[model samples]
Target: MSTAPTLIFTEALVLLGGAVVAAPIFRKLGLGTVLGYLAAGAVIGPLAHIITGAEEILPVAELGVVFLLFVIGLELKPSTLWRMRADIFGLGSAQVLLGGGLLTIAAVMFQLLDWKAAVVAGFGLSLSSTAFALQILNDRNDMNSAYGQRTFSVLLFQDLAIVPLLAMISILGNQAGSQSASLWMDIGIAIAATLAMILTGRYVLTPLFQIIARTGAREVMIAAALFVVLGSAMLMQAVGLSMAMGAFLAGVMLAESSYRHELEADIEPFRGILQALFFIAVGLSVQFNVIFDNLLLLALAVPLIMLVKGLSIYGLCRLAGSSHNDALRIAAVLPQGGEFGFVLFTTAVSAGLFSNATASLLISIVTLTMALTPVVASLANHLLKGEAREEIEEDFEGAGSDVLMIGFSRFGQIAAQILLASGRDVTIIDDSADRIRQASMFGFRIYFGDGTRLDMLRAAGIEKAKIVAVCTQKRDVTDKIVDLIAAEFPHCRLFVRSYDRVHSLSLRARNVEYELRETLESGLKFGRSAITALGVSEDTAAAIEDDIRRRDEERLQLQAVDGLRAGTHMLYNRPVQPEPLVKPKRGAEQPEDAL
Candidate 1:
């Protein structure tokens, strides 16, 4: 007898197959994973009808958002958040308030639904996709750019505003008979629930993770991670608040924990897959029949909404001190609808704020807007590609020296400064606008751009330079710059900064001649201080440090040839022969030259 395939099995196949097929293709086409997942869901559920109902998948997939907020929370502690007060409160608050207000007015003028419904639509559309925008910014290496910071600050504010908006929705939409609990009671429960999660994270969860980690089982650790997420989510849901918000709070509390990095590493893959599923569910929710019936309407409405949102955000960015080009970049990248659009829309509808038809239309428009983000950002980038500054090009034209520094971060700055003080003409090219700006304040002619770019190197006169020093400790980036210079400008001497012994060996494997572990020298100096603090003579401590340094350098040089044998020798702490230092008595005077 023939048996029907299990529904779960079929659904899983459809979801996985869709993602597997679409992700690489869209990524290859430079559209990014957001569009890929969206397209997959559209084809599977809406068009092909392979997976007809996304209802069962959506609630679990919604946890994707919870995980995302959790990760975001981990990255932002109270102190870090305080330090960004200007960006968060000033720029961020302005974007949401202004964007929401203008949209509300425009909707009211057009007589879209009514004042109440317009309020929902206004604040709803004001949120840009955090995941999408961050991905695009990181891909372009612009997350540290002024525009990038501004856009992120605004996004952060929007994420926070979700809690207040929820409370507002419940207040406005709760009819007399429909109320489940008093507003004050619900508020109290929410507060108590948040506190409980924080306490549990600090006292209960940390110990629990510590115990679980000792088991030495990968599955147990993964299980523990999932337990924390789902447990916190359930606790929050029990208290009449957003589950995702509770997860975010839990993450914030755990931000200071020693296990944070471990937890993050475990949760990241799950977040990505679950988030993809969430996007897929969004795609499945699209009603193609309705879309096709009003294709022309959507075609116009989508662009209109995107234009309104983009210009509104751009204007706010400009008002907040972004340059014309920077404002354009922010506008182009953030005009799209956010994932929160779906969340708030569902909440709005359940509260009887708008009809299903209106919701569907808005959802369609938002999806289309998100799909067009990459195109919009590319065009905006093109618009910002003005000719290289005359002053910059002219300065680079003649500024060839014996020294070329590839980074201008804290590490690179010290190296560049020492060379500059010693009368060397050093051209430092850095990718960070912040670093470059700070360097300019100190009268350094630091150029801002990626060192890996061949044109940038040529402009910096890499061919004519003598020493190419890559002082950035990011091994991947350091290795890339090292490869570029070694291949094209082999005559130049290369000095690289490594994070540790392994990183140094990796650089050595790449045939890098000069590699200094970033912390090794400072650590040695600190070691000398510790020796002296224990009552050893300063001269003896200094001599011991010198011997240690000399032997380590000798080992590093030996390891540069074949790393395998030499690396093992260094790793095992093989003994080195050296003369014992003679300590001076307390009454004795130091040598005159040493003094």
Candidate 2:
């Protein structure tokens, strides 16, 4: 009898019901959503035993990781990865090698397995859970943080290393030179597949996106994006590489494409739910029998492993130039084992390098780590309270705005209102934490920081910005920022808020294209309204107001020139010379003769 439909339905219910219940509970308990997702998986897999296809669901769940890698790759330009090459190759390599080496020694001492099995176990367990770490870092908006970036570089390296690691496991299992040759073959195929993806992405994907985008079909665009990710992953998998690796490579290749943002937009929804499913699968796969039977060993193993890995990562991050607090965060965030340990342990067992008992114990330990990841992240974040710069930066990212307003004081509200009214993408940045909070309460996504900083500007997408309006109250501070913006981002149109007549003159001297005196227009409006209220008709009042504005502008223009002259005179250094204009009567009279 064909039971495929029934099986599928049951699996769907298990996943759906779990998610439906877990989200609210986790939220109410003030736990991370990941905890809810994992709980759902546990409830389905271990508690109700609703589905008999956890293993089948494993591969399906892995699609989330694949999509996630692809999306991460989209974020990682070659330049970004290259810039962090030291961290990737240095800290990342050492994390795997030294960490694995230490773990292997510990495993041997504990008599967990023979040296060969321990070696495999060590390498596998040394990896931090990428999904868990990135999810936390991303949620907290620490993706660009010093500690977050360094730790992520290590995670990325670990992702890349999975290919070789898997190959190594296979070779070790067979204990054969032939397996090594097969790996070389796979590597060649992997290279070819990668090149194919790049070339195809460069030539084909953008055009496809454009055609679909023109049709205005959201569903088609999303389907096309899915195809791209899944296709790349499948191609890589077909060539002896992980699907995530392939998808990631594809994503990186398309990072700079015109369609990159659109692709991200389309793919994000799928990646989130799928990634959640991937986490749920991890929870579901946790073996209660193995844990209960070997409770003492697993318990002893989990804490020890986390401690060693934590210390190792902390020292490594410190060596990489992170602050002590940041190092503590990096350490705590990454001590947990990764999802790949399951694959590694399975490969080892299938290859006869490890017995069923050892594999079960190791898998349990890995699952424990995965389950505990959110708690660790929460604790780390709590300990680093009043120091959540990562989260602060993250809130700005979601705005993905085109216009960045540097100050959110009363002056800033004018530009903000205009932009908001016009339905323009607008983001506000201010140094005052209290002001930022107030704006947030009033439904503004205000980024709190000293906006004059280049790092802050970049974080707010200064490069991609169309307009930047500086409305800070201080003239000198405004001028300093104007210079920075002029120097760094000449393409951006700057609209600076001037404090008064002198500030406006200063701005004009600086060759600012747009300078609005803070009180000039408002004071003019007050005069116009008063004139109309006194006796004049509204139209006559407007005419009189316009005429007055013209005269004042003419005077202002003359004054601006004089201000420039005055500044030049102040800075002037006359050469040592005879006293000027003692008597020039004959030459001075020449003006009449010339006329």
Candidate 3:
């Protein structure tokens, strides 16, 4: 059979079969679907050799990476990128340069190759798999944590850096005069094409999307999104750039558009399928025979690469202003070689710039490193846990101030400032090293510790504190802290930030006082005031705001009472009763009907 037909059939069968069989098993084991896909590729490609034509399968797999980049671009707004410039530029740049340079030096010491080859190898191995790392972090619900955000910023920068690195590699290859003036002309054309696409995407795509959106046709919207990605990718390829970069640029153009969410929703399914295939294809391409042959080399290289990358990351984090412990954790979490390394290694090998033996050795090392990242990250967490506990204890011992702040985030920072300016002896505790460093720079008395830990709270002078503000973002963390404070420091008044009605009730259940839903109350008041200012009837605006406030308070009370008894009281544990559309007569309404 022809390669094209074989590829199409294998892809469809593998995707469908893999999802049905592998997904549940992976979930049960608490591993991600990406691992499942990798396993699937191993079974189909190496074990059974069912997917016989890998060369044909690869281009299709490449699409998955392209689409993934597109989605990443969509997520990265200019403002968000700007906010993370420190992480992206400082830590990220350092990781690449230092990690790569160290690896190059190691390669030379090993007598593997000349300086140029060693440099290429170093650059290839410095990147940690953004796909794998991010997926694991997201699965563990750590994406919102300080370490997770820092890791993500570094990964984002690496993805952006790939473009320039690839360009340089191409330029160096052309310097050998393998191709004529056509090579340089091709490079210039590619640069112009990429630039033109970005300009057109920025100026024309949004309005074009707006016009398509007027049709209110979901299919057309999806088609348009696909067109932008595929069209740009084709343009990029025609001019000698990677199609992935084009798709990424197209995604960035749509980042701030009004239809961003719509485009995302439309293309998400395609992106997911393609991305899974991409990972599986990576597994398929892993030459297991070669890996087995070089088992000793693989074993040695894996740990060495990880150690080098980890040390580089540690130094970078410290330079970026993280504390010693935090720097260690960040370094430990990002020691693996990334997906891009696989791509780069394969490209260099195909171009005859890397020896078969060297390429095989590098691939084996990269794969092993990638596989071990989760275990390494978990070990890092374990090591840091002891230090974290000790720090919490010390912070609690030092506590006994007039005011205790549970979280030193943006909201807590402001609260801490006002309290301190008013001459109160304030002690702040936060889990984020980045935030703690900022606080230290500004001369705030802050301790690095989890507020949810009862011992930490006690050590933070919670018992003696006049007020304890639970100003953290996570509702679960806030609730735990409130419960602990209520149990151990009953005299201290607790003020907490509630994200919504649900969150307010969670706090209220623990008998937290001064619960403030950051948005609901403030938003209602703002809307009402705006209407009143716009010549709306004062009575109407007042009535609306009052109704919202009343409903909010009532819901909080009902949820609080229900939450207290749900675990032990059968009556409270009954399935939730729906509220009436219209308010019932006062006397006719049950106590539960108030909310």
Candidate 4:
């Protein structure tokens, strides 16, 4: 009997049970699931010792980060990265160099470590947690915003920055001779591996998916998705780059594939579970004893490091021409220690730059910062001027058309098609990146912009357009765009999509040239088709539909003057019979038939 199997089962059970119990409770408490998982891991592993070997679990759990990067990569096309070059190179470089320099100075001024160790530690701590920051952004649905893009660009540069920083540790350490040469060799290998992945993804992946899809076996497709993600991850790991970097490259390669959405759908479940496990694993790895021993020192150090990093990022974003709100958001999202810090610190310890105790103390500090990130971010919300929203550049290169459509959501999408088919030049704009990408694949040219902004509206050619169609999904958003247009471009005709009966009345009050309730036409058509299917002829059905439409218009006009409940009698209803006593009458009718 192998007790090893039982131990493994017990650990799995404990982890699953802990996650199940903790995530919801913390979510209900408004602390977020990341913190919940951390709390649960802390209780089960460090405090109670219900589960052991967290260190061993960490390597396996890091797959969560790898999958997360892969999913993010799917959302970004290479062209999108090209568009973000200035931020990635210029802003990212400044943050790392200046931020690392500031932290190094702080460490040295305090006599925290020797010069060699301080250099490594400073840069290491300058790196913020990609997993933690991204999770926060994703939960808030802000990953595609201007600030989010800038934040991600900085994190990406940090990931690239790790290689050189690691090389610097080799040159500064006691084992400089062998480690330096090995580090250079590893760099070469990483470059070659990256190139290989690019070629394989370009030439092999799409066709492979095509063949598998032809087979119509959904399970095989899922396995293939997993294989591609894990295989790319392992290749990068083999060449000394982070596994996440490789998976991201693979995702970028496949970004233009027609199957991109399907692939995302396939990988999402695995990414979610693994990501949760990764957060829990972070919690389990918390060294409470070390934290307690250095409580006073860390109390000073953690906030100092976060402050230095946050101020540096905030300053750099402002200088780079970001709005004050965006700068504040970028600062709030990234002012914590990163997962890569653990790798750098442990490496420094091995190279004789720092002792084991020092590494433990740094690790403890990072863990505490990771746990505190959500709270710090929450605090940042109070400091923002207004509700923060994701914004994209308003490009109107070929705009200024006959019809300007404000939103490319489902309603707008359908309306645009009708306009296009009728040979109308319609300019479409939408704020959703996913919708933009999907629409682009189908040959739709949509400008990325928020329609509520007057500048964005002007750029999209509201003044030149004969009609401005407001087709935003949300009622409030639609109202805002309509109001802005009515106020700013009063001469322009407005065609608005109404949410419901009440909304139709409100839009009418706003004096739009045209307003149609979103579901009214569809509901009427469905009823007509259903009646035609049962017994009514097509001509009769058409007449019935026309009658209903006329009655509805009449009802709306009456309701507008008399209030919502004033037109109830216009709706058709079956009349009730008060009494029917036909038994004796039936006998009288039988007598007539007999005669």
Candidate 5:
């Protein structure tokens, strides 16, 4: 009885128990689950010495990040991703070049490490922890915000930078001549693998899922999804690229597929568990002895790394046209050394660019920064000048319908009710996160998105809609949506809610199929009720209401043709003696007669 099996089982139990106990407690304290997982791993491995072999568990745990990137890819269609090319390449490249350059110079000036080691360390430290940043953004429901998107762009480019960074390490070492050809070969192979994954995902994956779907075995679907992710990941790793990048590419290829939601549903549980384990594994691998030896250097290095990266990110974002607030938020959210830095530093040690002690120092610095990220991000709020709006995921599952409602404000909500009562299917989309959450409480299945975005409209299924209803609260937002639909989807019928009489006139001028001033009917009903409560008969009140509505429509038509002042005579603005406030006596002429 070696007890090896028992030990393995015990370790698994400990990891699970730690996660179960730690995640919720840290979340309750608002410290975040990332920090909690780190704390749990620290306690279990380094502090308590109950678990060992973090090195062996780490590679498997890293698949969590792979699945995380894949899920993120599923939200972004290729066309949408293409729109971000400028930020991804321009802003991202600038951050890496500038931040890496500055850090390398500082390292050399301060005699931190050999020039070669410093080079690798500088670039590695320039990269921020994608898992940490993304987790925080997801926790705050900010992944779809402009700040989050830009931050993600930089992170994406950094992931891309890993291949070249590893190549640089090989070049810097004595193995340069021997590995130079291998480096180029790796790049070529990575490109080929990426192309193969894209082709396979585009041509083979959906059909395979469709076939598996016909079998109707959910277990098989889950297995197939796992196979796809792992197989793609293995292919990329074999070619010297990242497993996460490969999974992300596969996900992007299937982003517009009908089965995307099913795949996400199947993969989500595994991603969560493994991702938590990855964070914990990182915590387990913390080298306390090295930290104790270089405590003073690390204290200076950690804050210095954060400060340099933050300033570089903030300045680059402003130069790239981000607002001061957005740039600062991006900086606050992303100043940590990434998990990729661990990989880079370990590789550097093997490549003879640095020693194990040096690598441990860098690793400790990275870990400390990651641990401090949440606290720093929270503190950033005090520095913020204005409020940042919360953003939700743009998941448009089950969205196609005959009636496409663009906004979910009060008017749209009431209109949606009538449509639902009539047994019509409606797909509603709104940009407001709070409104979407509130709507869910009342049983409305609305998607979160900006209606003015053509891609969002398309995702909400504008092509399948028979009627495009624009009921946004703001006049400008309404006009932009209306104009967008009118330009891109002329065949669809438009039914618009106008903010005022001027909006009504504008909509009519644009040849909208139907447009109504949102307040007109309610205002008329209130007047009708008031007149009926007085001396007017019900029939007279109704007739007067109808008459007023007809006159208002006439005035709107006139304004549409001529100008605002064109309908002034019809507004009942003639200077006359004031009317009595008291109800008229019975048998006196009613308001209808006066009309």
Candidate 6:
């Protein structure tokens, strides 16, 4: 056997290669790059045996999870998390309890396991893949949808749940002795560590980052951020908690800090590569032969586990006041065992709570279920067809609007607010119940339904509406809405917000009258400020903007024509066509010689 160090290097190289090769193919297949990573890991670890030392690869893989959790933490502001309290606390709590409890019962019955073992199994199996679900939702442009928000809420709760779960696991390990004090001590240490980190982070990290940023040394900032993550992780581990928990807390601490955006940008590339490696490591760890041997048991357990979790999630979503269709959608998306479940399950086996055979069985089941999620989501889409239509119609009929905003997000909200203030009747439609409630609180009328669906558009007064604005986060959904508007509401002026340049071009192809890249306007604002700072007169700056605007309008008209012929209208950065400084009536301008 090769030395551990050599094995580690070999495995890392293999994983890197796999990710590079598989990602593009998966993208082309419309399956997403995540699936590509999984496929790569599966091929190298199990099928090809490129990296034989799976155990040595585990820790490196775990770094991916840590980075991913950290990024997730950075994105969540306290206010946003607080607003999702109902879904996170209420529905999330129910999902963990009910799903875990039922799974525990089944484990006891089928595997004839001890109560402690069964409980561990149950709790472990209850989680759905946050990484997988989030990535897919992001791909589909549904991350800001009502269903997406609820899904994220539940995932956030699950991430937090790891704390108590770890504590309980430690407690369960010492059940033979009166070790309650140790559990309490562990919990106390964890809380203290988290508080200390938060306080220190608030006072120190941001300033430190600002100093580093001013130097314009990218590597220094990267190193400082890494130190924070690794240091926090080490401290948590010293306190007998998981490194992941510490990473998550650190992220939350930085979420509202001034340097949050900078920190995120620096950490993102590392997070992506590490997370992909982590997924690959998971693939490598799977004992495919063992799964084949216990195929019957694995098959029985997988479906039953998915069914229980799905039903529990669906019930909780409904109880949390989600529409039936949305509840069903949540159920479909989250029925599988999550990445955390695999981690917990493997830990239990290593701790002697489960046999190697059983661990392999459970892993196999979880893997199969996770693999099935995209297919399940596709099925849910078909099942929930037409439901969005009825809801949209009812909402629009009630609003009696002449203009419809499909997504009541930041951009959409501003547009709706301005129009409403201008005495224009506007109907707002969004998928997030929380957003809708908040809008209602602010006296803005909003409806809940998928905006991409034609039924929802009609329900939102599509035919009567003179304008439609697609300003959601998802490009695909935006494109879909644009197409629908062009087909059905041909006269309705279409305005869309694209996530990036590519999305803007896609919208332009659909002959959208107004397409704005979300960041472009902000970039232009910055450019104007810079020009003014550089001693350009305010009038000159304004004229320059006007000139650029005129060119952009002309480009849009040209793009519309190009879009009709081909599916894309590519924009190039060329010098704007210089306009005549002054114009005279035809045949009225004097020749230079005459002058």
Using TM-score, give the best candidate's number.
4
Error of 3 at 513 (Å): 15
Once superposed on the true structure, which residue ranges of model 6 sit more than 4 Å away at CA?
A: 1-10, 111-114, 141-146, 163-175, 214-216, 385-564, 568-595
**lDDT score, candidate 1, position 185:** 72
Q: Estimate each model's TM-score.
A: 0.65, 0.66, 0.66, 0.71, 0.67, 0.70
Q: Per-model C-alpha lDDT, please?
A: 0.77, 0.80, 0.75, 0.86, 0.88, 0.76
lDDT per residue for candidate 1 within 1-595, as digits (tens), equals: 2344676777888898889999999989977777788899989988888887776787888888778767766766767657767877787777777777877787898787688888888888877887678767867888767787777777776766776666667666756345435655767777787788878887888788889889999899989888888888888777766667677777877888888898899999988888889878878877887788789877876777778878877787788777789889999988887777777777888989978887877777677887788789877767785734423323465556778788877788778778989988998787776677777888988876678889888888787788888987577888788888888887778888897877787877777768888888889999999989998887777766766777677666665554444335443334333334344333445322111
lDDT per residue as tens, model 2, 1-595: 5798887877787687787789778967977777888888887888778765578787887887888888888888878878989998899999999899999999899887788888899999999888888788877789878888888888878877787888888877766677867778877877788788878877887787788889988888888889889988888778766788788888988888888888888888888888888878877887898899988988888989988998898898877788878988888889889888888898889889988888878888988987787787678766663554533444455544788789989989867988999898887788877777778888888877677788788887777777788999887789889999888887778888988766777788777778888887888799889977888676666665565566556556766654434334231233222222221123223211111
- Model 2 C-alpha lDDT versus the unseen true structure: 0.80
lDDT of 3 by residue, 23-112 (tens): 578767855666677777777888888675555666877777677667767876767757888898877888898998899999999987
Model 3 regions lying over 4 Å from their true place: 1-11, 79-94, 114-116, 140-175, 178-187, 322-334, 385-595
Q: In model 1, which range of ten residues has the least summed lDDT?
A: 586-595
Worst 10 residues of 5 by lDDT: 575-584
Each candidate: RMSD: 11.3, 19.7, 7.8, 10.3, 18.0, 8.0
User: Residues 1-595, candidate 4, lDDT per residue (tens digit)?
Assistant: 6999999998888888988999899888888888998898899999999987788888888898999999999999989988988999999889989988998988899999989999988889888899999999998899999999999999888877877888888888976777867887878887899899999999999999999999999999999999999999998877778889889989999999988999999999888888888888889889988988988999999898888988899999999999888999899889888889899999998889999999989888889899999888889888888756566665589899999998888888888999999999999988887788889899999999889899888888888899999998898999999888888888989999998877887788889999999998898899889988998777766666665676678667765665443234322332222232121122213211111
Clashing residue pairs, candidate 6?
A: 392-459, 393-459
Residues 134-250 of candidate 6: C-alpha lDDT, one tens digit per residue: 767767888778999899888877876776776566567655356677767767877898788778777887787888889988899899999888887778777766676677778
Provide the lDDT at 405 for model 2.
Answer: 84
State the displacement of the C-alpha of residue 450, model 2, in Å, after optimal TM-score superposition.
14
What does candidate 5's lDDT look like per residue over 213-308, in tens digits? 999999999999999888888888888788888888889988999999999999999999999999999889887888888888888888999999
lDDT of residue 414 for candidate 4: 86
383 in model 3: Cα distance from truth in Å?
Answer: 3.8
